[model samples]
Target chain A: MKKINYNRELCDFCGTCVSVCPQDAIELSENNLEITDKCTVCMNCVYICPLRALEVKNEG
Target chain B: MKDRYDVIVVGGGPSGSMAAMFAARAGVSVLMLEKDREIGLPVRCAEGVGDKGLRSVVDINPNWIAQKITTVKLISPAGMEVVIGTDEVGYILNRKMFDPGLAELAAQAGSEIITKAYVNGLLLDNNKVTGVRVRTLGREFQVKASIVIGADGVESRVGRWAGIKTWEKLNDMETCAQVTAQNINVQQDAIHLYFSNTRAPKGYLWVFPKGNGLANVGIGISGEASRHKSPFAYLFEFLQTNFPQAAIITTVAGGVPCAREPEKIVANGLMLVGDAARQVNPVSGGGIVTGMIAGKIAGQVAGQAIIDGKTDEKRLAEYARLWQKAEGKKHKVFYKLKEFVYNMSDKDLDDTAKIALQIPQDKRTILQLFKTALVQKPALILEAIKVLT
Candidate 1:
């Protein structure tokens, strides 16, 4: 399984992750951005984050 | 908060702000919403705008300009360089200040401006967009409007929510990454563009000088190439090789729609502008000017629609007609040029660079380069002349 980790402090909520996500897994609320379970570890959000707030880890 | 407005513009970038300003200037009640708490934080663009385009839309404000550009250098894959002098000059903007400044202009023009107001979806009445449902500061609200303008950018949900078919193919999306770095050596008055398949892969890299050893260095890669490697990785490598000692000040990454405007941009009671409408220049990947132009048109038409009490697709079609006449025709040609240039092999690019170098440095112009690049398509010569001259 692949899991995603988010650093809330680093996130500026620019919503680039939500924009690039192929799985429609990210959403931005007023203060925080949520990555849903549908995130397929595609790593698009991880690479696109200007603040480097997202990380994807492979858990075997 | 007022639940109704004559015009509701979603997004506070140049397009949204301009739309709000023009709409409000016409005595219409306008409200502009920005998703971010700050207008232009986490800036995603290289921030370069041509002088003519900027002057056409807004007054030249010294506070908004970071550097004045007088020249552009095109470097080929094989390291050949062709430098072209700009006729009207350009500017690398301080977007952090520029975006807010435009928002302030909108506010001053009698438009209500709100930050941290993230538009979540569209409010539709009988398959026509009538308003937007926005979430702000942990509270959600629905604001009704006679007209809705979606200037929300490339990942525009407002357009999608309205069923406008805003989907873009992978090839049309350019994944981009940029950093403002200090202590980098750059020509103070020139923007350097590097074209190479190995470096950018179906797109190009840019070093836009922001004066005094500061520059916005960035790379844009086609979505097809981005699927194989991250744009950030390429940018990192480029920086390590070029400006190893430079300190990174700010980093940004996003996608630019390098495609023609969507076939349909206006729906009943709603319209799309800027990146939401995919109005970016296909070759340069710049949208600020075009967005503002579209914003002005949309705003004017929107205000007129409100005045006439008719906000249907037919009335708003004036915006589409006007924008297509203004720059849409040129953009269509640029799209074809982008497809042609991006598809060129490294050898072809190298050959083109060699040809460009043959022109006298003093005589070298952007139009001449375009002429060389489009030599195979002799049919486009007249169109190139129309664009350049």
Candidate 2:
């Protein structure tokens, strides 16, 4: 179960994830976006995202 | 062991208090926490609320109001003023007093509220939100709740703690600074908006009256434009040249996100309301009414979910559905419209304003004004007509 997942290649670096995530799990660190905490995998960010930058991936 | 709460309301702003009040009204065990020693300290809003929009949720209290406005005077960059008249424009509230009054209303509605308490994060059990860990006065404690309502404002931490995306892009945010001042020359009852790309690119300056030659004058510039100078710097220059005699009484500087909506507003047993959810208007940057509206919907749905004994993501998503259905469609349209509007050049804006002033005042519908501003074809105008009419 990949607890934290995002495609940096796809992210527009919009910071939409920073404002909407409830856990404060996602933040732009060192100008590179990183998902800090293991997200609930709710897909709220992936779904509501206008750019479709993030998604849930199985943590193998 | 402390008492269990049916709903834990965090951040004792208007939205939080409203959530606590509505939840407690349903006979639920509600607890509201305010980090500040006193609620509504360091006020951060223009305090304007439309009469009709506000009446949809709570009744108006005469004592809470500061000034009753009937007209809005909009000024273009070249100083062309357009007056919009309405029977019930809005009231510029005394928010320092009004915010606490809302919390008092929640208390009166049987909700227990504590001041000087900060919520650290959510207590998760089996990946479901169960409670919150709070730190108050150097002491840490945990409180369990069946449901958690995050009424935190623009810089909401609770939303992030629960795993909801609370990030706002720079383009979607307006850096604003306002001041309450005296000796203002603007009309007493008319709210004024000064639009100039040079003054506030991607945003506008506002002069809202506070009665008796006093007013709250402010300006918001989008972050992209603000790279050259801060909103405070731009506003001070404007005031020095325009209203140099005015004496400042108080100042408020903050960020207002212009999101069509937040990245997400719901997750499992948690929900974000008010500015936390990015429900502020895309154009005017007003959030009080929309926040309260979304708060009522979120609180009502959260309370029902608690009574039903289920607080999962699917169950709580009703809050999101309710809010989206409330104004989501308009927001989508506004987002698209904002992109188009902001892309206009300074000369384009001045020219558009000149053309708009040519429209007969009585025929100045929103559609007509928009058409004048943008050289849209009849098809686009018709599309807008269908949606608006």
Candidate 3:
């Protein structure tokens, strides 16, 4: 299973991934992006990035 | 023998009806199931749609229209209004009649419509959808079909049951409450949008006139800050101040998904359309056009598959491919854009409004406006600027 590896370092603090995630899996804490347990790998943020910052990691 | 049809469309909304209509015209037997006893009763919409989006399919019928609009007025958070001059090219549809009328058109095209039929589950065979189990009129029955389309709106359970990942985050969803009130003093020719933070924190409020002193007054706020208070509470506050003299006629409350793209609407042997697919506009919370377009494509693919006798996941991947080919890139881009725009601070919005107000009325191209408001990569902004313009 591939998991999303959110690069907090590169994130623009725009919350695009947070709003586009259908599962409400992403939250913003003090301008830092937090990936929650509810994530279902929708990839809405991965695809919706204007900055191309968020990445995904698949687990074997 | 178990019964079977070419396509089983769940939800008799416009998209489902259009799907059934197109598939039936392609010579496939179609069955449309609507949970509501009345197909278009208790209307739930701002009732406005762009003219270009409607012209692609059916001509705008006069009977279905409440008003034909020609101008739009956008107000900023600071109460500064900018009236744009575009070809007045939209209609406030009388959904009560228009919705049922579209279903009737589907029936005329040889599709069978079953109202009051609530689909409770999807019948799966060998990990693939084969039919649906529905309860209606105090009885339960099952119907088999080659293709199943989930056209049920915003909070669709069918997509979830089929493992399509239909969840919407609280912050991404816009809780909406609207009402059509009579005896109001509002501009009948132009739509009014209020963008003040005091009115809506994460979203905006709108007043769409339906002619003859009637208008649909509504507001939507992002679900993130709206956890404690209901959408009705927010809308009531606005109504009390703005339209205090207006008589209340009807009220509607629902959630609108503002996500740029849905998780996945297409899977092996199944597809979703309309609000179920989250095909709505990211900014406006409008889905009528996008849903209709998706339905047309899904209908075409389903028809061709039935003719070829290949309704499996591999074969149905074409629909997914075609959808992405048609609007996937735009959806991806819009998702990012929506996030950036929604995150704009009140000060940012105020400054942007100042810039917009400075531009001469004729010089307001969407590109110039977005660029002036945003300080992001030109490529993404340019792409979005071109698409919206």
Candidate 4:
């Protein structure tokens, strides 16, 4: 499975990813941005992050 | 602090503040929660509102006005430019100041606001919302309220938490990027909008001047079209061609819910306002005014419902009914118009630009273009007349 990873340094936390996420997995706030269990590694957030703060991590 | 109130508003944007302010004025105890530490920072909008749209809701404060606009410059991909002059006033607002100003009004109306007080989820009782679960730096607790107004904007979770279908499909979502830049050359008193496919597929690029060579330059591409190409790419291309010498100051990206306002914005004891309900103008992707309008109606209805001890979906439907009667129906006309306009090919747009030039200068208004576009649909033209005029 491929899981999504986020880098806090690069994130703007603008909630762009939350709107485009088809699975409704991303939760954003003033200080924290969490990708919950509902995320299916859809990569919508990864592709759409304007700051490139998110990526996909492979699992074995 | 007390854990109970008559109403709780989530998010502190134009809609939330309007909801909170009006509800509090109705003599109900209202609590407004803001996820941001500040009332207005990290602006996610182009911040332009029509003169009439602003005045119809509230009186204008000079401090919030960044610039007064007198003309609109519409440009085509082929370099065709049509300048339409307007007598009615328009403004490019300083939203960093404007949003908080509205929140101040809410506070003056006796709405208790807590910044950085994030409402993480809804507190439902037997399928009816009774309150909200909030987390602040000080502590976390559940606060009870008769109604919750979700004015949480495009990334709204409150509506979803309340079990209303709130997701905007990719086709209806306008993925966007914007920058406040300096040392750019453009008309100071006019807003510039560029239409193209390669530059902004199924969307448009805008330059709103804020005087002294500073402007908010932005672009929006349909989420479906932006699946492969990001809005950043399109925005960079536009800046490269138009303002290569410009120095970028701030960059922000987001989505505009360019979909139809949900048929159901009210669930049991819950009402969604603003972008949460997708009350944005489908054609322009602007909601600052429409959101406030819906917010006022939502707050009024919610206050009355709570005072009458009936806050269920049946009673809350009055908000939706009044909003739909006021602007939601017109939004439908604009949505249909959006489908027709956004689906046009690059060539179709350029041709339309050429055809637009054929009309006399003073007569070439946005309404004229809309009438021409919907010529095949006379019924739609009739509705547009009711909306535009």
Q: Each candidate's DockQ score against the native complex?
A: 0.24, 0.09, 0.05, 0.56
lDDT of 1: 0.85
Local accuracy of candidate 2 as per-residue lDDT tens digits, B112-181: 9988786767898886778898877678899998888888676577776766666665677776778899
Question: What TM-score number comes out for model 4?
Answer: 0.94
Candidate 3: count of backbone clashes, pairs at least 3 residues apart or interchain: 6
Model 2 C-alpha RMSD to native: 8.1
Model 1 DockQ (Cα-based): 0.24
Candidate 3 chain B lDDT trough over 10 residues, lowest sum: B375-384
Worst 10 residues of 1 chain B by lDDT: B380-389
**DockQ-based class of model 2:** incorrect
State the lDDT of candidate 2 residue by residue for A1-60, as single tens digits. 656577776654434455545556664421256777656765445543333456677766
- TM-score of every candidate relative to the true structure: 0.90, 0.83, 0.82, 0.94
What C-alpha RMSD separates each model from the true structure? 3.6, 8.1, 9.9, 2.8
Model 3: fnat (fraction of native contacts): 0.07
Candidate 1 per-residue lDDT, tens place, B246-332, comes to: 899988767888976777899999999998898999999999999999999899999988999999899899999999999999898
lDDT of the candidates, in the order given: 0.85, 0.76, 0.75, 0.86
Candidate 1 Cα errors over 4 Å, as ranges = A1-26, A29-31, A34-60, B374-389
| Native contacts, share recovered per candidate | 0.09, 0.15, 0.07, 0.47
Residue A49 of model 2 has an lDDT of 38
Q: lDDT per residue, candidate 4, B219-251, as tens digits? A: 988877777788888899889988999899989
| lDDT-superior candidate, 3 or 4 | 4
Which order, best to worst by DockQ?
Answer: 4, 1, 2, 3
